[model samples]
Target: MKTILLPLLIGLMLVGCSSSPSLSNSSSLYQELNGQSGLERLVDAFIQEIAGDEQIFHYFAKSNVDRFREGFITHLCDVSDGPCEYQGDNMIDIHTGMKINEADFNRVVELLINAMEAEGIPYRTQNKLLARLAPLRPEIIHR
Candidate 1:
């Protein structure tokens, strides 16, 4: 039993390692998002989706759309193994007075998902980005 289990575990580990992306290639694939250029387009799609939503547009009426958009792009790029640094307020502080609730956050996430789909980003890439951003839920959702 011990011998069989050991071989099985080793085989699993080899499979996992083989399927994983190399750090350098991952970084290069991230850079393919056109660095700032690709990020800019992604941000535009996400913002347009958000702005079109009647349920959420009011919340951003007075907000700096361009700045928020760029910040989001930077954050996404940085988290996706891209060569960029995000230098904005932390997630919690940024949404302090905005009173964003779970529903609102979810709506924004959905919009982001749609935007990613519209850009033809594969599901794996989308999931990778989402996984990185998921931890910010607690900080961004005020309610």
Candidate 2:
């Protein structure tokens, strides 16, 4: 009886595992944003907007815009559940010495939202991405 029940249980487990959905093929926020190329364009637009904004432009004045743009794209891709990995420093390590305050962080978020809108990404999708990024505030602000 024990041997028979064990085999039955094993078969049931295998069936359940095989019927489960594959997360890799699932529709992600990354796909919704049109994948890597779309993310690159969105990052470019966001960086441009940041450069022009008086409130946050000073933060980037001494930084490498091109490198930042690339890292930003990679970071956003990772955040949006894309296949790309981010090669840049983590949020706390990168922003530790920057002394970014709440207002500055908020301004950056606003600029990003505007940039997404300009790129024709829908509002719900923008919010989804923003929600994923919102957790980084502690590592980014007042640091």
Candidate 3:
């Protein structure tokens, strides 16, 4: 009985070590954001809110919405430590001629917060993501 128990415990330990890491074992913010699907939803909510806001609608007038959504999701995912690559232009290049002011940037941030709320993302998680993104303001705000 003792010999059998020893082999069983060793087998269990080997199985545990051989198992692949899952979301449950991951501490990535991407997992916290629910991965690609959740990020996609968050981006959609943000775009929808921005589309109706007079102050920012014009900014997207000449843009490709679908591509923007995809890239935004990728960007957010990458920033959140997810396994996604951002294919969009760098923030500096993207906003170079946009002349986005502090007020404009703030408004977008507000809209993003609203979007996060709309998507049922917790406030703490939202703040975590926002904190990660706050450093990009210098590149995004041209004026």
Candidate 4:
């Protein structure tokens, strides 16, 4: 399934949950993400990853690269319990008319995992971050 403005929805998974004690309410995951600068780097790499993916690039080809970068970084920080807030649109609002489906949403998750791996984030830290992201899934897919 394909969708429009998928890039704007990239960081939607990074917010809306804070129940996890290890990563969501603590700065440990943020530290693992290398703080603000590291989140920026991760967003940059994620954009590059999306740009290089033939399957995904077309969806992002018309996106505002700068906005995605900044929003993604801020969301990453917020999601990782860093000192930042995700000031972008809510998940439902951002993805409502896009018609995003399960496969595409999962693909984006895969891309995020790839970006995290490229950033040298450990498997443990990565899992923690993913776990934090689980609850927000319902707000995103098929919206």
Best by lDDT: 3
How well is each residue in 96-132 modelled by candidate 2, as lDDT tens digits?
A: 8889988999999999998999899988789999999
On residues 1-143, what C-alpha lDDT tens digit does candidate 1 reach at each position? 99999999999999999889985455654665556777778789989997899978998899898788778888887777787788898887888888888888899899989988888777876777788789989988873
Comparison by TM-score, 2 against 4, better one: 2
- Cα lDDT, all candidates: 0.81, 0.90, 0.90, 0.81
Model 3 off-target regions past 4 Å? 1-26
Model 1, residue 50: distance off in Å is: 0.9
Model 3 gets an lDDT of 0.90
For model 3, residues 19-93, the per-residue Cα lDDT tens digits are: 957643657789888888999999999999999999999999999999899889999999999998887789999
Where does candidate 3 have its weakest 10-residue lDDT segment? 20-29
Q: Which stretches of model 2 miss by more than 4 angstroms? A: 1-26
Error of 4 at 75 (Å): 0.9
Between candidates 2 and 4, name the one with more favorable lDDT: 2
Q: Cα RMSD (Å) per model?
A: 5.8, 6.7, 5.7, 17.9
TM-score of each: 0.76, 0.80, 0.80, 0.77
